[model samples]
Target: MDVLQIVAIGLMATVLIGVLKSQRPELAVLLSVAVGVILFLLVLGKIGSIVDIITDLATRAGISMVYLGTIMKIIGIAYIAEFGAQICRDAGEGAVATKIEFAAKILIMVLAVPIVVAVLQSLLKLLG
Candidate 1:
């Protein structure tokens, strides 16, 4: 973990939050949200690197790229859902955030259906 990066972001967020609460509330709110989004983007780059590594490993192991892709999609959905939910909560919209989480879960399940079916079929073939 990059402690310095985390500390820098934390300090920035804290200062902005304090500024927002005391004076220039509107700008403070915007600053907080902008900071959140910037952090998310930075983490997303790391996630992309992880996905690339997974794809490389899967290729080496002769696993289907489609399966790897599905897994990565699931990870992305989770990250996005969490990011959105946290932002909403931070913005004082807990109810909306919960709904967003629910929607994301449903979408993930729907997307996984085909992958599940494929896995089941592959298993049955192996057994037979």
Candidate 2:
């Protein structure tokens, strides 16, 4: 998970995609998708470790699992949305990318409502 290695690979892929785009646009799109998947796979192990750390910290802090789960879902949605949006953009579908981003934001807001409500309830209890 070296940043430099990932950057190098990305730069190489960009060059290859650029070279292929004129001659075989379909292949270029496939190559971009492949690179995105590969990059995501490379980071999955790191993501797992991060999740473990967060879970452990939450447990130690006596935080509600529901809150932790919601946070994780929100983070997952953000990453997935960004990934989809970037892929769409790479394929020259800016409108589709924007739509994906907009949908993701809406989903994130929906997921966050529970947490917000919980906080507001706690504040009301304290004030009362």
Candidate 3:
């Protein structure tokens, strides 16, 4: 199965991290981050395809590309934030991971303001 590949890579990395944790703690952290990135990259192609499909549908539905772009940025921020948080957690820094997540959520809220405004305008127009 396609998912098996991800599992295999994850298992291998887990083993390596365990082995290196005692001898080289720093390298273990690095290896964890590198493996995380590699896994993300492996599925990056699917992400591109999803973006294309969403773009096409948005175009057909008369949705503004500006909104789509904003949404995309929000999603990117979320994924990156999660990735960073996971790395921090793996390095035994739970506090740092929580901070990273908090920052990402704030950023997401900021980015969402435009879309929220646009939606409110549409609703107001409908009521009037």
User: Top lDDT: which candidate number?
Assistant: 3
lDDT values for all models:
0.82, 0.93, 0.94
C-alpha root-mean-square deviation, candidate 3: 1.7
Can you give the TM-score per candidate against the true fold? 0.79, 0.89, 0.88
Tens digit per residue, CA lDDT, model 2, 1-128: 48887898899999999999999988999999898888888788898888899999999999999999999999999989999998899889999999999999999999999999999999999999
lDDT of 3 by residue, 44-98 (tens): 8888889999999999999999999999999999999999998899889999999
The residue pairs found clashing in candidate 1 are none
Off by over 4 Å in 2: 1-5
Model 1: per-residue lDDT, tens digit, 50-119? 7788788999999898777777788789988998888678767899999999999998998899898998
Q: For candidate 1, give the lDDT of residue 81.
A: 92
For each predicted model, how many residue pairs clash, with residues at least 3 apart or on different chains? 0, 0, 0
Q: Considering TM-score, which of the candidate structures 1 and 3 is the better prediction for this target?
A: 3
- The alpha-carbon root-mean-square deviation between model 1 and the true structure, to one decimal in Å, is 2.7
In candidate 1, residue 119 scores what lDDT? 83
Which residue runs does candidate 3 get wrong by more than 4 Å? 1-4
Candidate 1 yields a Cα-based lDDT of 0.82
